[model samples]
Target: MGSRTQDTEECYSYHNQNQNVDYGRMAEILVRRAGSTDEFTRLTSITWINEFVKLGGEQLVPYYADILGAVLPCISDEEEKIRVVARETNEELRAIKADPAEGFDIGAILSIAKRELNSEHEATRIEALHWFFTLLDRYCAEFLAYLNDIFDPLLNALSDPSDAVSFL
Candidate 1:
């Protein structure tokens, strides 16, 4: 087991050294692993996920966006480490929403916002929804129609039982 773990670490190091590797694919696998039920796999994957997001820049924004979308649904992650990962993921999403690029996908952003609005954690959920509103206000007419379409669902969800609803 020690040798296997060392081998995995070496492979990860090798990939990190190869700057030209397909980060999107690598992130996708890590995201999948993070969702796994196995304790070791999930913890290891969360580490990779956090590392992947921390390598932020214009080139990595898309990958971070993908990671946010992939992990937002894991609101039930009990481990403190995984929760920290989720929080970091939320922060990254907010950053992306604040200054989205031409390549940014509004649909993907909305999906994550919607997921957050439904989160079990009140603070995280409310913050996510607030970020959504901030994004809407900033984008204005550009995002008006999309906001209109989602407003009803968001309102109804907010009405349902959740700590986030009280703050709404």
Candidate 2:
């Protein structure tokens, strides 16, 4: 119980809230040695490294993009931290004319994106829309015919009482 509390608090300790040089090098090491050889290493690569980048800044963020051979740790990633880095990496690549998913967990992303897109909260809606747009933009050909279906719930949102919701 004591360790659990410490772990939870340590997860986002203040010291980790920036792009610290020490953490960046550690993230690089984790990303490089990330292999299917064992669960611990894989989890380090998927979870801790991404957490480092999320807590760190732009400098550390770049290494996450180089980690190759993700077996779905991004799209349907079990850890939120992993998913965040994956999304960030996608955006970076999109800037460079690269496909975001990069052969990762493309299958499960759509359902989660759709569910989040209809969230009642405006902030939730905004974040979800970002993901949805990335998906649509990355795979324009595949998502074209299904835009209406994907965007159906948002249609009624056109008349939402809140300016933010309605405008979105």
Candidate 3:
């Protein structure tokens, strides 16, 4: 009976170690899956942003940035499904701006503004320009300069119809 109890203890320890190993592997898999360049990942990001915005707790801001970074580059992606990711990103930015917290990064906002201005879609360009102007009004000297660098060409492009603007 004494030997059986020792054996049982060893077996339980082994089982716990195996569980830990499995959990570690599962965590890695989940991270990779979330980071995947697939439509499902993009959809999940969109859903997460929508939900996060609705909840609007302070803790989720960094998570918002993380998801945005992961999904923003896919804005110009060829896949139609992934395009929704960009739209959601724009919406998330709009939501963030509505609250106007101290933690917001002007540089990142400016980058998105430039991308929107350069978008091939006329509607997106217009929307992007609107946000650019809003940021310009709120931010200081350096941000204004950044805004000018992006906005000047866009204004020129809009004035001159010869320039092709494609959002895709």
**Cα lDDT of model 2 overall?**
0.49
lDDT (C-alpha, whole model) for all candidates: 0.63, 0.49, 0.50
lDDT tens per residue, model 3, 17-103: 653333222222222333456656545445444443444433344343444444454555566665665566556655554323545
User: C-alpha displacement of 126 in model 1, angstroms?
Assistant: 3.2
Ranking by lDDT: 1, 3, 2
Stronger candidate by TM-score (2 vs 3): 3
Q: Residue 126 in candidate 3 has what lDDT?
A: 55
Candidate 3 Cα misplacement greater than 4 A, ranges: 1-37, 56-89, 97-101, 140-142, 145-148, 160-168
Between candidates 1 and 2, the one scoring higher on TM-score is 1
At residue 100, candidate 1 shows an lDDT of 53
- Would you estimate the TM-scores of all the predictions? 0.74, 0.41, 0.49
- Taking the candidates one at a time, how many backbone clashes does each contain? 0, 0, 4
Q: Kindly list the per-residue Cα lDDT of model 1 for residues 112-146, writing each as its tens digit.
A: 77766766666556665765676677776656658
Model 2 C-alpha lDDT per residue in residues 62-141, reported as the tens digit of each score:
44334322422343344565556555644443343333344333334455555655555554455445655675777777
When summed lDDT is taken over every stretch of 10 residues in candidate 3, the lowest stretch is: 22-31
Query: Which candidate gets the maximum TM-score versus the true structure?
Result: 1
Q: Between the candidate structures 2 and 3, which one is better when assessed by lDDT?
A: 3
